[model samples]
Target: MQPGEPSARFVDIELEPGDLRLRTLVPADAPLLVEATSAEPGRSLWGPHPLGPHSLRDAQAALAEWDPAAPGQFSLGVLRDGRLLGAVGLIPERPGSIEVAYWLRPEERGKGIASRAVRAATLWARDGLAVPRIWLEIEPGNEPSLRLAERVGYRFEQRVPRHCRAWEHQDADRDTWHDCLIWTFGTGPA
Candidate 1:
């Protein structure tokens, strides 16, 4: 990563398949943020501490903070026919691995939008960024997420106990933690 170089290849990438598209997130997407947090405000692992209007501000601030050339952890807005469907993020967690995070609006679920988005993102990370491995951490019992990962070619490796908690439950008791399944995309099954 250089001072002015982008952390990922999202800048040159514009994924558009069918009516769906994935583009680097911008402040203009703040309204979409508001729409997204309407149903589940203050609940996201990838947004502000309290996900809401305040989170929108936070997201805006984050976008402003980045130099655009070298974005660190970046979020991309998922849109269909010019409407926001959800968001996906690429976070370089370590040297050889990048974490893939995504979510879709309730109305957007079950439409295969998320699956398409994940597949596109992983492909970008693998080919564009030359990422050796991709990781997706999902809370236990989240069948949809698990299935999405599986459908996109990720295989379950192990469960990390208390690795993370739902964003809404962050203030709950310490024992109230989410057992996340660590799924990975690598050369072969782990």
Candidate 2:
């Protein structure tokens, strides 16, 4: 909530890098998000993220609350050339701080899409959102995510145990108990 900002509502955002484009998430995106993450060799983001088969309807419901022109929680659709890529978030929490997270389609991985989206988010959080701290948490086992966090200028802060819960799998032994690595950027908020 700021003096003047968009009301809590979904935004239509479009970011283009050469031939690629990133836009805000929409309710129609629910199925695509589900499909992308559910596709095989998907061990990438599935383990630690709560998004799963059951998330489609729920994610769609949540789309009503994501606002890009506002100064609060933001969830955006990751789009490239009008195709759904994934999602990215810069959540408002801890006052003057936000937690940044991004997930890309398996086929979209390794193309630096997530990195670019993250960089865009960091810039937004810093300038658009006027936040001092842009933080992110990555499951210890997700090396690529960790690299993205670091590559985006987020520095290693601390390890928080069981900081993330993986609800996708039925096997408890999947050790869904994740150790989270916290990364901070720009001198973090006081």
As a TM-score, model 1 comes out at 0.79
Score each candidate by Cα lDDT.
0.70, 0.66
Candidate RMSDs in Å, in order, are: 3.6, 4.3
**How well does candidate 2 score on lDDT at residue 58?**
49
Error of 2 at 32 (Å): 4.6
TM-score of 2: 0.74
Clashes of 2: 2
Question: lDDT of candidate 2 vs native?
Answer: 0.66
Top-TM-score candidate index: 1
**By summed lDDT, which 10 consecutive residues of candidate 2 come out lowest?**
40-49
Ten-residue stretch with the least lDDT total in model 1: 2-11
Query: Candidate 1 vs. truth: CA RMSD?
Result: 3.6
| lDDT accuracy of residue 44 in candidate 1 | 47
lDDT tens per residue, model 2, 1-190:
5512545334444466455555555555666656665653433222333444426664555554554554555566676665667778767777677787777776778988788888876776677657788888888888998888878788998899987766666766674677888888868643
After TM-score superposition, what is the CA distance of residue 41 in candidate 2 from its true location, in Å?
A: 7.0
